[model samples]
Target: MVNLKLKLSEKANYLAFLIVFVSLGLASQSILAEEVHEPAEQIAPHQEQFEAGKFVIEHVSDAFEWHILTYKQHHISIPLPIILYSNNSGLNIFWSSKFEHGHASYHNFRIEEEGEHAGKIVELNEAGAVVGLPIDLSITKTVAGIFISVFILIFIFLKVAKSATSSTGRAPTGIQNLLEPIILFIRDEVALPTLGKDKSERFLPYLLTLFFFILIENLVGLIPIFPFGANVTGNIGVTMVLALFTFVITTFSGNKHYWKEIYNPDVPWWLKYPLPLMPIVELTGVFTKPFVLMVRLFANMMAGHMIVTVFVSLIFIFGQIGGPALGGAVSPVSIAFSVFILLLDVLVSFIQAYVFTLLSALYFGMATSDHH
Candidate 1:
């Protein structure tokens, strides 16, 4: 009797399972039918919506305005000045808002939305062809960052200088108290070791300025806020300018021994006279040094910003593919890694700045080194 009852219960459970299985199959079939009936245009819109890489590129690249954040369908951004000059246009000055965030053209000029010129201001003809290159000396996001950094540096140093003068023989106080140790460290620890005590004094001001500028720019980049965090150090143009300064200083300051080592390196006589291999190699090293400096700082800073952005993007990527539950599950892991990298990036910021300044000083030492 117990076996008979168990058999009956198993039959009932099987029947209930079949009903659910059939229901799901029918529901899926209906969904498929509806999708087939829908027009291609309807599906095309969905395909355009999930673009992760685009988001990454847009965030890192320089823009005319500063995009703060997006809420729902509205984008909040600070408009910057758009200064353009062309043979035809003469000088067209306007706010970036005139372009409506790249949605419309203004005065026969539009920010290129696609292609190689994307994100750049170009003059357009009646036929919509790019007619001329506009000199875009406008104050862009990166430029704004530079201005802010310069202002801050000037303000801080000026305040400290005033305090030192006013205090006279008394102990240092306020901003002077804070900056004194750092300035001393760069002088005694960095410059003295690399350029020696006597020579370091002459270049101490420039070295100090270089170190502080890089350090401040790096710190500001990690903020991820408005009116700041413009990736100034990451921009190749800015890095190139910094490297050029080092190169110029090293070239002008090079002594007899320095040029002698390059043009007449202590190598096999055959290498110098016949092939001029040693001299050629040494001469090549001169340009390569600054090239390395430019590439190193630019690559490191840009890479850090890209990595942090990619990690944060993972959450949205998961949500798009696997629904909200999967996104929620991935959030903790993504945020954890991002935070860890951010902390490491802070350390990198100091290290990069020190490395740059230290290298510059070393080059200076080598350039001015006295040889018997």
Candidate 2:
């Protein structure tokens, strides 16, 4: 009996040791896996300087150079032209690479990293007060994006025109085939219905340009790739310019009736006699119409870009905290959401273009209406 008891005790001791050994082995394996997968160099800096909001805002905002991606300690970027016109320097033109990614200054000019003039070119005096402000006509990332979109537009339209002339009534082919229906859709569904056949004919060119320009910019901004991804339409300046064009066209197209409608609105006699309330309200609307256009486009496009960028940033944030395994686990969820937003943004791009065009056409129609 004593021998049997000793044998059983020996077996139990061996079993306990085996279990401890297996647990230790599994734990070591996990640690090794994490060490192997964690990208220490890439994530460490980001973790040190990680301000989630700042990271997100920077990605959405315009930059002097086009930042493509980063690997290790290297940043792959394309430096754009930094064209500046200053009182002292006249025309100072150079590639943005001279700034060494905003580290070094050149020719008494530097890219402002903070304050109201952040991301702008400002010339400082010896005491550091801004003395000479340069007119920055630089081909910034946004400008480069605009140039790319314009080139695409010119290329596509030229091809479409050539096809229209050369095909000689044959069915449209290639890009022409795809875009013809869209163009026709714009004319038939949007232009004719809003501006009437005659007015639509008069304003079709402008409306078409407006529609396609916004559509193309929105699509390009969504790409997040080189020479294409820029928040041009999302920029308030760009949207304001577009709105200004609509405002100017509407103002020019306004006939006597359109003016009379605002200045001497057909309202209750009391409303006009005492206060000109109707006219005042109508006048406010004239300006407000364009303001709404500018805000709507800028806000919508910017929001979409921000959301996608934020989701992408999450992967890095997780990696910084729990190493690559946690980051890898979160990536699938993050990417799925981003892809869904991107698809939604695609539809929004078209809708926004259509809405802007439709409203512009409607405004034109109202201005040109003879019945009023």
Candidate 3:
């Protein structure tokens, strides 16, 4: 009995040891993953102070720096850095000695040597040149992403449309086969449900375009590579443009009933007689609706990315404080949460795209509806 008890005790100790060993192994991997992808800004303060195991979250969150030119005009420039692993340093435009990893610089432009450096911009001899002037004209990561997304969507849609026309009204094939169902879902589940059939078709093209554009941009932002990771939809400028397009369409298509509800609402006799400033309030709401759409999408997407970055940064911050063990222990939880957020982001990308499309369609329906 004593010998049997001894053997069981030994087995329990071995099992405990095995569990500890496995847990440590997983924790080590989690730490490695966290360090390998550290943001550029988090790794180094000025691209000159990078460190190992701190590659992913080193770059500036927004990267916007204003430069005041000799001409006294304010210009804005933002750098989009390329992410690379230590082994892939060769791909970087410039290697960081501190980081031991290479990084490719984005928004590379020369400031005229003559200008005062107001932050990031330098004044040019001719006109104050923002280091990166005419943003839309440049070959930025966002621009590249936009072009790629546009091309893919256009190509796929055109092919599908052609196939539908050519095949005696049969269903599409290949890429079209993949896209047709999504299109139908948008039309049936999203468009018709919100805008009704007759009104929905008119706005279908724009809604479809917006949906794919936002979806592709959101996905591309996650890649963390050159000519990628531009947070296109998170940029307020991009969101504003999209919202403006929807607003214009909605306003232009508004029927008499829609305008009547806004300009001359059927309120109580006293409310209408006193000329209660209802018209002004209603008029303002027309613009506010699109503005809300822009802010909501931009804020939500950007916030998620920022939160992931902050959590990842904690590992490095803790490591520097002689708490490597604690940092190591915390790493698994942090990485798991980051991965969870990333997965959530994927769902959000699709949901935002759908929501934007559905709301736009609803507005169109309201605009074109026969009754108020």
Evaluated with TM-score, which candidate comes out highest?
2
Write the residue-wise lDDT of candidate 3 on 1-372 in tens digits: 222222322332333333323322211110001112334454544424325333333231323211111121211222322222222122222112222222222323232323353212221223433433221222233443454555555555555555655664454567657765676677678877778766665666666666766777777776555445666777776788778878998998898999998889887667656675787788898998899889988888887777677668777667666567977987888899888888898999888888887888877887787872
Per-prediction TM-score, please? Answer: 0.85, 0.85, 0.65
Q: Put down candidate 2 lDDT per residue, 272-324, tens digits, no spaces.
A: 98788999999999999999999999999999999998898899899889999
C-alpha lDDT (0 to 100) for residue 324 of candidate 3: 77
Q: Write the per-residue lDDT of candidate 1 for residues 262-295, one digit (tens) a residue.
A: 9998887998887899999999999999999999
Candidate 3 Cα errors over 4 Å, as ranges? 1-122, 125-137, 158-174, 323-327
Give the TM-score (vs. native) of candidate 3. Answer: 0.65
lDDT of each: 0.76, 0.76, 0.57
Candidate 2 residues lying further than 4 Å off, grouped into runs, are 1-47, 127-129
Q: In angstroms, how far off is 160's CA in candidate 2?
A: 1.3
Q: Better model by lDDT, 1 or 3?
A: 1
- TM-score result, candidate 1: 0.85
In model 3, the Cα lDDT at residue 103 comes to 28
Q: What is the lDDT of candidate 3?
A: 0.57
